[model samples]
Target: MKKFLSALFSLCLVFALVACGSSGGGEASGGESEETFLSIGTGGTGGAWYAIMSAAGAALNSDLNLDVQATGGSIENMKLVTNQSADLGFASPDTAYFAYEGGREFDNANPDLRVVMAGNMMYEYIIVRADSDIHEMEDINGKTVSIGAPGSATDIVGNEVLSSLGVEPAETINLAHSEAATALQEGTVDVMMALSGVPFTAATELSTVEDVRFIPLNQNEIDTVVENNQYWSGGELPAETYEGQNQPIPGINVGSLVIADESASEDDIYNLLNTLLVENHDEWEKGHNLASDFTIEMMETYVENGVVLLPFHPGAEKFFEEQGVTLNK
Candidate 1:
């Protein structure tokens, strides 16, 4: 009787252990379930960021089982990602750096954002009426200028550029790119500073206006501004980007990059980066001219340019590693 009782006890213990193991396996599988949706914060409806992000979002949703939603522009986008309010978003390097360092607009916000990928170099173009006497950057001292909508990255960079050049209180107007172009065409504003990727609709429209001219930022001024702000770089808008505008316009370029929070899972970031860089590259390029700029080589250059302010997520680092590319710390 004692032998039989001991045998029953041992069998019961084995059953309990098997049950616990099965439960643990079930929980592990649940944790590994796929994430199916993501959001991409972009600018106004007609901007380059919006166009590209919208297309990328569609591809991610279809190909990678991700649902990418386009929200407001850069400043708001950074806030979303930093607070974990959104999964993915776009931002300028300047804004990303400021937010990561808790400077400027991000002074009161969290500084734990990380960069996922670099997007493009948006050259700041200052356009004025061709018949107007605004030949140099200083010519718009007291004129009405459309700086850009409030809280937008364009506004932030435009304000800084103007302030750097000692052009204070220049009758700044807060208008979207399209609205600003209309204002310029109708003579409501004398000058407008538009910072965006090439083939921008607003700049292209402003070019078609019979009397508008592209103002060049001198090399000395570009160097001074870049010296003061590490985010600024010197670049030019090719004349071919605009119809009949046959000369390259010298200006300061700001990089647009995709950023996310450090809390995002490695797999999530890996999936996102892989979608943007590899699987969806050709499709993205087909959707917008700006997308043509998205390339692996450019991605490397973006990181090397000091544009990535936050630490790289481990998944992204791994993805780069698998591709045999080393990322700098």
Candidate 2:
């Protein structure tokens, strides 16, 4: 009787251990699907970056959980991705290059930064009141200017352009795109120096209320800003792009990028891209007007044009390759 009782006790212990293993085991052993949760850092809600990323997050909800966080823009996004605070983010091509190379602004080089895909082509709009004396880029000296949000692509690039053009503002303020537009409308600011896609929403909404015109950067000025920078290009806003504008407004332009941390899983990134770009193409594109630019062809063109300046994430490289797009480094 004693031997039989001891055998029963041992059997019960074995059964408990098996049950614990099955219950506590991870997806690999438990036959459960692994759920990936990620966060995307974007620019202000009123900007194209936020709109495009938010739409993507919504479209990708079925496959994985994504949180689109509004950020200060390019510089902050770079810092967030490098610190693993954000799994993915957006940045100007020049900003991404700067972060990777630790150019001036960055304290140290971030080797873990990788480009997931190309985004929209950003255009600079040096906006001013239509009736103001600031008719040309040279007239900005000693005038109050809103140089975009602090640490954003616009702030950095706007300063660079000002320096290149030898224009000095009396004071430079940092404000979100919409806020700057409001300030301009209220005469609190003399000019709004912004970098965004065509028909920048803030500018558009402001145009409906106040008379505004984009300061056209002459060919020489455009050339000067774009010189020695492969990431920079020239863009022109055709006439009628904004109310009260009768002529094309030409300016400097730069490509935008969607970047991811190097530590992220390649297969997961590939799958996400496949779902966003292929399976949910229609839905994703319909998310925002700018979303239509988020296409594989646009990425390929950016690479061909030397607008995409960073190394592709391994997963992104795999996904693009499957679509017959060769990423040049």
Candidate 3:
């Protein structure tokens, strides 16, 4: 009799668990799907990518009832999304394109990669103390220069530009943005290349302590770089970007494409993007200055800017199409 009671109790417990599940989830709750948890991969701390994406993720989490986390930057972000460690990523178009094609730094093709949004970024320059005598791109030939850290967008772009310019600095130090800026201020490094939106925090801060000057690339130099490399757009750094700067400086600007993994559901991607652009526009702006530049037009015209070499995700494609914006596949 005792054994019979135990078996009956076990059956009842299993039934209760099933009942609980039926009442709580899996199409039983008004046929609505369960909330999804997501992660966004961003750049390192104190950078524009991290600042912008973190703000967007927070806004999505609150308004859409989703769990979202922001971590890492550029190349790291691409890996995180490809490996399914992150559902979304913010990266330069060149980096993502290389990953998709199995070229450049990556050996494997990630054909499943797709873009969600295209955002703005500007050309950063090789910074030096204004008082110093390093005047042009060729001036740094025999000086100590800190290239950006490996696996960084800055490193990739800077290396290409330097090689094209035929610059072989006396010493090439690999340092992150902040460290390179600090070293420049301390006179430990003669120059450092930065590639981000204008008024980069570290470079601006460095300007405050020392009148920093950016090495300007002339139109011929710009044409030379873009002749074989179409990933960049030729532009000028507007005035007042840094201390004691009153004139625009010629440079190359490239934008970034925010992408997502293919495994994510269309509904979730649609909802998250809709929440980001429509509902939380103002809130997301609190994250960075470039937040105001996130618009449908950017994504639509990205190919013209050479900022998008990959196709958009189906969900994103549908959303844009609804607004009469026909993207290039």
Candidate 4:
């Protein structure tokens, strides 16, 4: 009787251990489940960045099994990703470089950021009253030019452009794009520098004003500016994009980058890039003209553009490799 009782006790202990082991395995499997939600940082309601990213996020959600959220604009977006408050966000190459290098805005940032993919090219145009005396970039000195809104990529880029021209923010009027347009139209502000996508809404509206015209930065000056600061590249603003303009305006082009935190797994980045480049191409094109610019050839051009300035995340590098393309490194 003693032996039989001891054997039953052992059998019961084995069953308890087996049950605990099964429970542990189940928990581990649950922990390894996929991340289902991602947030993208974009700009204000009327901005193209906001519109394009929002649409892309929705398409990614529906097609790639992702739950994408588009929140505020650039500065906020960079903060979200760097702080791990967001999964993905949009960044200008200049902003990305600043964030990575601990430059102006990211001087206090802890986690250095990187770029995942180059998405679009945005031009920084300075729009002023057509009759205003500000015919040259230098004329902005000591004038009430709107440098862009607070906490915006426009503000950052605008500041850089002004600084490149030896202009100081102290001499400028700091206002959001909308406010600048209103101020210019009201004759309260003399000029406004807005860094935005082509056919920018704010600039378009400003152009519609009977007295508003875009100020063209000289190509030689633009080249010199970009040469000194690797972040800015020379680009043209087609006059036809704006009202009452007959000539292309020389300006600076900054790249829009799709950025993610290092915490995002390789597979997640790979899947995101794959979905944007392959599965949802048509859907994206239908949403924005900028989407049409996203092509394999353009992707290659972005890599070759020599101004990315930020390190490509390993996952992005992997994607490029899979496509039989080598990164510029």
Best model per lDDT = 2
Say what the RMSD of model 2 is. Answer: 3.0
Which residue segments of model 3 deviate by more than 4 Å?
A: 1-35, 61-72, 304-306
User: How do the predictions measure up, each by TM-score?
Assistant: 0.83, 0.89, 0.88, 0.80
Quote the lDDT for 160 in model 1: 87
Residues 67-136, model 2: lDDT tens digits:
8898999999999999999999899987898899897578898978998988888888899998899989
Q: Sum up the clashes in candidate 2.
A: 0
Q: Name the 10 consecutive residues with the lowest summed lDDT in model 4.
A: 26-35
lDDT of 4 by residue, 1-329 (tens): 99999999999999998777656432433355333556677665546676676667666744244434444457778888888888777877767766777767776754457678777788887887878888888877778877776767778777777777786533566676777788889878787777778766677676776557788888777977788777668998886887888889888888788788877878778877778777887887777777766555566777776766666777888887788765776
lDDT string, candidate 3, 1-329, tens digits: 99999999999999998787677544545566666666777654545666666667667653244334434346777887889888888778889898777778787889999988877765757788888898888898999987776677787788888888898899988787778888998899999887777756777777888878888998888888877577777888888878888889998887888888777778778887777777777877776667777877777688555567788888888888886776776
lDDT of each: 0.77, 0.86, 0.77, 0.73
**Once model 3 is optimally superposed onto the true structure by TM-score, how far is the C-alpha of residue 215 displaced, in angstroms?**
1.7
Which candidate wins on TM-score? 2
lDDT string for model 1 (165-220, tens) is: 88765599988888888898888999877778887777776677655788898988
Which TM-score value belongs to model 3?
0.88
**How many backbone clashes does every candidate have?**
1, 0, 3, 2
